[model samples]
Target: MISPEERNRTGRGCLLGNWVEERATTSLDKTGPESDIHKKGHQGILTVDWSSKLEDTSTQKSAFTSSKGTSAQQKGFRYELMKEHLIKSISEQVHAELTAKPAAAELHSVTRRDYTAGGFQWVRPTPSTDRDYKTDQAITFWRENFDKIQGVTAVRNRDAPFKKNASFTCPITECLDPNPENDLDTEEK
Candidate 1:
């Protein structure tokens, strides 16, 4: 549930966007709300965890910056209880469609930070002016969010160095060469 603080900040034009990408699970009670809800055996998922970090080099906001994080803006929430319900629900839906498979649930974090910032304290994005996010980043967020469930592996942001983080994925780009001193990894090169 959104809080009073969230409402106030959002009213001031600082919006909140939350997204999730979890692997599909085989546990009946784990997928949507359960902590292990996204345990994989089926495929994957899509959801929001929006922020404003984007493709800016001046303010140093790179496209690699995440839009989602622990939403430490809400005051009080029953994460465990909600997690339980969410897992059951997502599990039901996934299995209902393909009765042969199993699933579980988990809730995205509603926990908030101590300092009050814009709704979720999302970093002001490159297009800091883009509140509604007309048709660019929001669209990419929507597309990438869905792509996870579609079983599409994440590709590296070629402009960014190959590295890993707790949030986004860049599994295969580690071998790319920054200079011609090393062999190129793909035909595109």
Candidate 2:
């Protein structure tokens, strides 16, 4: 049986995975509700544990800085901390995806900040923004390597009616046209 911590971790990982999937699937819908949902996700509160951990680290760094640490040392410390978290999260996420069975999950720290200027907060990105950013980045990456994703074609068909041509007529107008013969004997009394 998975422990509570493991469950929490996995739940977090699954949440991220689901978010990524949503972003990928809704990549083409710019004006859709998914984008709004994604924006909300980014602005939502940071996880409590991650926030506490960041606070503790910031306090330690501040104490160390005040105690004989030079400016360069402070800069180095911040850089290392940010790098460590990024590296750690990326690696762990990959490992979890690979080794854990499809049923299993893990927590991923989507945000990271250094211990400086009131510290940084890890904010969970929304599916929409993540998708948008991913789409933009993917386009750039693919453009650089045109050979890849070149054959990938997407066809979008608009469901809403738009004026196709100047001669185009409105269905509503046709229905409401006041001609006794236009009813073709189908009009109800």
Candidate 3:
């Protein structure tokens, strides 16, 4: 069977494109006055869900950037993206699992009150061998999903509270004291 891209190359993809186009255009061909229900059914469902998810991810990314990420246990894009990809795959798997369940079957789940700081943490089933070399594949994945992560910061101190350069004692007092050679009093202080 020809893929969408292959079909498009031969100009036989009109029907597939039309189907997708029609789904998108369903909301625009409205006859009656604007109603929330109609909008929700046609446009709101996919648009609202996707946009809100993207927005949340964007916010997390912005927050992460302003704050620094962990240094010691710093994970590279290869590991992190692999984890993210696996997560997406597992979630799709679970969804598929649930979908496969009989209509009348009851679904049961255990509930627990968790206190983890970061939310999107996932365990990798398969680990990469080379831990030294900087791989382009991981970096590419990082760049691609960098925007999707809401709170994955590139900054140095992700946990450091937003300070206007307040002269608080070093967060890790035992390790080192917070001091600067050039005491340029910025607004953050």
- Residue range 19-128, candidate 2, lDDT tens digits: 57545544333344544646655321456454454445666676665555555654577899999999999999999988976755555444423334455586987575
Backbone clash pairs for candidate 2 read 9-106, 9-107, 10-105, 10-106
Instruction: Say which candidate scores most in lDDT.
Output: 3
Q: What's the TM-score of each model vs. the native?
A: 0.14, 0.16, 0.16
> Which residues of candidate 3, in runs, are more than 4 Å off?
1-73, 101-189
Give the per-residue lDDT of model 1 (tens digit) for 86-169: 999999999889876555655445553435557554675586453554533333454545434554433344222223432344
**Candidate 2 deviates by what RMSD?**
46.8
Model 3, residue 180: distance off in Å is 99
Q: Which ranking of candidates, highest lDDT first?
A: 3, 2, 1
User: Using TM-score as the measure, what is the rank order of every candidate, best first?
Assistant: 3, 2, 1
Off by over 4 Å in 1: 1-56, 59-75, 100-189
Among the numbered candidates, top TM-score falls to 3
Off by over 4 Å in 2: 1-75, 103-189
lDDT of 3 at 118: 57
